[model samples]
Target chain A: MVSKPPPDATRRSEKSRRAIYAAALSLVGEVGYPRTTVEGIAARAGVGKQTIYRWWPSKADVLLEAFLDLSRQAAQEAGQEPYAIPDTGDLAADLKAVLRLTVDQLLDPRFEAPSRALAAEGLVNEPLGREFVTKLLEPQLQLYVDRLRAAQEAGEVRAGVDCRIALELFVSPLAQRWLQHTGPISYDYTDTLVEYALHGIASQPPRSA
Target chain B: MVSKPPPDATRRSEKSRRAIYAAALSLVGEVGYPRTTVEGIAARAGVGKQTIYRWWPSKADVLLEAFLDLSRQAAQEAGQEPYAIPDTGDLAADLKAVLRLTVDQLLDPRFEAPSRALAAEGLVNEPLGREFVTKLLEPQLQLYVDRLRAAQEAGEVRAGVDCRIALELFVSPLAQRWLQHTGPISYDYTDTLVEYALHGIASQPPRSA
Candidate 1:
C-alpha cells in the first residue's frame, strides 16, 4: 500500500529522525512535558516544524516515540535483544538477569530526569499517562508477560498464577524504589526481588533455586 | 515547652484545623502541587493566612499533615486500628485485610486526586520526595515491616527474609497499579497479591494456606 523511499532519501530522513528524538528527549527533561513544544523540538533538531508534523500528529506522539527510541538504545547498550527477555530454562536466573539490567537503566542519569519529568506529568495528565503506558510501558511489560507464560509452559511457574500480576511482584518493587526513592537499588536488591517473588517470603521455601 | 490553651479556644482551633486540612486536600487535588498555594487554601478554608503559617511552615507540610489526617480518618472509617495491621496468627489473612482497606482508600475519590497530585510533584522534587517518603510513606511501610516481623517471629515468614523488601512484594504492586493506572484495583486483586506474596508463583506451593 506504500511506496518505498529511495535509499539516499531514507538515510537523510533517518538522520533527521534521530536528531528529532534526541532533541525531544533533552527538551522534555530540561523543561518538563507541559512546556515542551513541537516547534521547540523542530528548532532544536534543526528540522522544519512541518517536517515534525509530517511524521507525528502531536507533541505527545513525538515524545512517546522519543522515549521508545531511548528504551531501544538502552537495551542495545546493555547487549539485550530489544523487547525480549531471555529464556534459558531457568526462570529465576533469567528474571534476575533482566532485573539487574533494569537496575542499571533506572540509575542511568540520561534516562532518569526525562523519565521522572514525563512520569510526573503523566500522574495528573490522565490521557498522556494512558498513552505513555499504552505506547511505552505496557510493551516492555508484555515482554515479562511472554517470559512468564513460557515459564508456565515449562512448569517453572504455577499454572494458576496470573503472569501479569506475577511480573509485578519483582518489577514494581524496583520501580517504586527508583521512582519514589523508597530504597536503594542494586543488583543485589533486584536479585532478592526475583528470589522473593519466585519462592516467596514465607517460612517454607518452595523449592531450591 | 508547650502551654495548654483554654478548652474553648482549643475547640475553636480544632475546628479551624479540620477546615484548613480539608482546604489543603481539595486545593491540591483541583489545582495540583505547583498551582496550589497557602493563600488560596486560606481563602478557601475561611482562615487567615497567618493561621495556616502558625501551624505549618510550607504548603508541602500542610499537604503532608492533610494526608496523614486523611489516612487516620480512612482507617477509622474502615474499622481498622490506625497505623497497625492485625495479628490473627494468619499473616496472609491480616495482609489481605489491610491491603483491602488500602484498595478502598486508593480508589476513594476524596483520596485519589490529591494523592496523585502530591505524588506527581514528589517524582521530580527530590527534597519533597524524600520528605514524603520519610514522613508519609516510610511510616506506612514500616507498619508492614512490623507486621512482617511479627509473622517472622511466629514462624510464618522466613527468618532470613528482609521484612522491608518483603513487604514491597505485595505493597508496591498495588501502589504501581494505582499510581500508573497499569491495572484494576479491587479486593480480589489485593487478596491475590497477598496470596502470591506468601505462597509465591513457583511450581511448588510453599504452605497449605
Candidate 2:
C-alpha cells in the first residue's frame, strides 16, 4: 500500500532541520566538538532547545546527520547519484571518477573544517569514532565493495581477491593523506592511484619467445 | 681532538632522563594532550619543575623526544637497527617482515596509548602534525623509499614508479585501519595488501599465442 505524503508541517520541519545542520556544522568548525553545545546550536539555528532535542538525542547525532546530508547535497550538486557509485563497465574509469569527486569534497571549504574537527575528536573518542564509522564511513566503503565485486564477476578483477581489501588499496591512501596532511591531493594523484591499483607495480613478465 | 668522557654526573642525568620520558608518556596517555602539563610530568617523575624546564622547553618537546626515545628502545628490543629497515634482497619478504614487526608494535600496550594521544592531537593541530610528520613519520617513510629505490636498481620494482606513492599502497591501509578502527588489523591482512600492491587486483592477461 502507498503511504500518505508528508504534510505542510513536515515542510516547516524540514526547513528547521536544514538550519540546525548548518548551525551545527559551522559551530563545530568554529568551536570544535568539545565546546559545541546543543543550546548553542539551537540558538544559532533559531529553534527552541527542545526542538533540537526532540529530533536528535545529542549534538553528535545532529552532527552525524548533518554530515550525511551535506554529502548527499554535494553528490547531487556534482550530478552524481547519492549512495551509488556509477559503473560504466570500465572499472578503472569509474573508480577514478568517484575518487576525483571525493578529492573535491575533501578540499571543499564547507566540508573541510567541520570534518577535521569531528575526525579529530573521533580519533580520541572511541565510541564516537565507532558510531561515525558505522553510520558514515562503512556505508561509503561498501559502495566500493559493490563496484569491485561487480568487476570481479566481469573478469576485470581476480576472482579470489577480497573486494573489501582490494578497495582499500586505492581508498586508504587518499584517506590517510587527507587525515594526516601526509601528501598533496589532486585529481591527478587520485587518477594515478586508480591506475597503479589496477596495474601491477612490478613489470609484466615477458611473453614466451 | 677527542671529546671528554662523561663523569659520574652523566649517569645520574641519564637516569633522570629515562624517568622523565616514562612519566611524560604515561601522563599524556592517561589525561590526553590538552590536560597533560610539564608540571604534572615533573611531579610524576619525582623531579623538580626546574629539572623539566632545564631539559625541555615545552610539554610538546618533551613528548616528541620521549616518543623518539621509546621508538629507539623498541627497535633495539626487537633486535633491529634503530634507523634502518633490513633488506633481504627479496623486496616482498623484506617488506612483509618489517610490516609484521610494525603490526606487533601497533598492538603493543606501551606504544598504543601515548601514540594515540599524540596522533589525536596532531589531527587538529597543524603545526604539531607537520612537526611529528617531519620528525617521526617522514623518516620512516623515507626508509621505504630507500628500500624501493634499491628494488628498482635490482629490477624487482618497475622503473619510473614513484616509490613514495607506491609505498602508500601497502602502508596507508594499515594506518587507516588502526587510526579509524576501520577493520581488524592482522598479519594476514597486511600480507594481502603487499600481494595486491605488488601484482595489483587486475587479473593477468593471457600470453600472446
Candidate 3:
C-alpha cells in the first residue's frame, strides 16, 4: 500500500517512533518481555496506544526494533558502520578493533541487563531466539564473514577455509563467557584471540613446508 | 536431629533416590525450573515428600543431583573417567576425541531437553547458574586446565597462557553452537578448533623465539 506523508507529519511520526522505542527498551529491561504490555509502552512513551499499534503489531515487534536501534547507535558510537567490518588487508587489527568494541558493549551497563533479559527469554522461546539471531546477531556475524572472505581473496587466509565457521574461533569464546559467566573478558584477551585464530596455535603452521 | 537407617531401608532409600533423580530431570525438562516444585517431584518420583527432605534440603539440590547423575552415566558410557580430561600427552588427539564424544552427548535426545531447560533457567536464575558452574561445569573444565598445564610444562604451549582461558578456544564454540543453535557441529569442526587453539591462527610464530 502506497501512502503519502507530508514533511510535518513525517517528523511527528519519527518523534513518536523514538519515544516508543525508548519506552519499549526501558519497560522490557525493567519488567521483562513476557510481562511487558503495549499499554505500558504507550503510557511510558506518552503516546496513544493507537500510535504504537499503527507502527508495531505487538510488544515483541516494538522491542525488537528498540534493540536494533540500540545496536545501530552502538555501532555509530564505535566509529564504524553498523553493518560493515573494515578490511584493510590486516585481518588481525580489524578483528581486534571490532572485538574490543564488542567487549565494551558487553560490559556497558546500559546494554547489559536489557540484552541479557532478551537473550534469556530467547533461549526458552525458539521463535524469538531465531528472530534475534537472524535480525541482530547473524548480520553482525556476516560482517566478519565478509571481511574474512576478502582476506581469502587477498591470500591472507587458507584458500579452503569456510569464513562462516572460521569466525567462530574468536567470536564464540567471548559469547560463551558473556552468556554463561564462564570467564573474564578484556581487549587484551580478544586481541590474543585474533592472533591465535589468524595464525595457528599448534606451535607450527599447518600449511608449512 | 540425627536419623538412623534400618537394614532393608538402605535398599528402599536407593530405589527412592533413583526415582527422585528421574522425576527432577523430566519435570524440569517439561515445565522448567521456576515451575517444577518439591511436591511435584515427590509425587512424580512416587516417594513420600519427606523422603526427599530427608536427603536434599531443597528442590535445587534435587535438580543438581539429577544433572550430576545424568552426566556421570554419559561419561561412563563414553569410556571417560568422570571429571577428568584424559591426558594422553598428545593434546590435539585428546581434545578431539573428548569433543567428538561431546558432540554425541550434545545431540543425545535424553540429554538435550533437560540440558536446555536447565541452561535456559541458568540464563535468568543466578543462584542455579552459579551452582551448576561451580559444582558441575568448573570441575569438568578444570580437567582441561590440568591437561593444558601439563602441555605447558612439556613446552608445547606458551608459558604465559592461562590454561582455563585457553581451553575456551576449543570448548566455547561448540558450547555456543549447542546452546544457541548457531551452527552444526562435527568431528572435523572440533578437531579444527583444537588445532587453532594450540598453535593459534596468526600468520607468524611467537617473537619470544
On TM-score, the candidate that comes out on top is 1
Model 1 misses residue B165 by how many Å? 0.4
- Measured against the true structure, the TM-scores of the candidates, in listed sequence, are 0.96, 0.95, 0.93
lDDT of 2 by residue, B69-145 (tens): 98898888999998788888888888888898889889998988888888888888889888898888999999999
Model 1 CAPRI quality:
medium
Model 1: CA > 4 A from native:
A205-209, B1-3, B204-209
Q: What is the C-alpha lDDT profile of model 1 across A64-135, one tens digit per residue?
A: 988888888999998989899999998888998999888888988889989999999988999999989988
What local lDDT does model 2 show for residue B182? 92
Candidate 2, clashing residue pairs?
A: none
Interface RMSD of each: 1.9, 2.3, 2.0
DockQ of each: 0.68, 0.62, 0.55
lDDT of 3 at B157: 68
Highest lDDT against the true fold, candidate: 1
lDDT of 3 by residue, A99-185 (tens): 999999999877877787787777767788888888888888998999988887886776667778778889999988888777789
Docking quality class, candidate 3: medium
User: How many clashes show up per model?
Assistant: 0, 0, 14
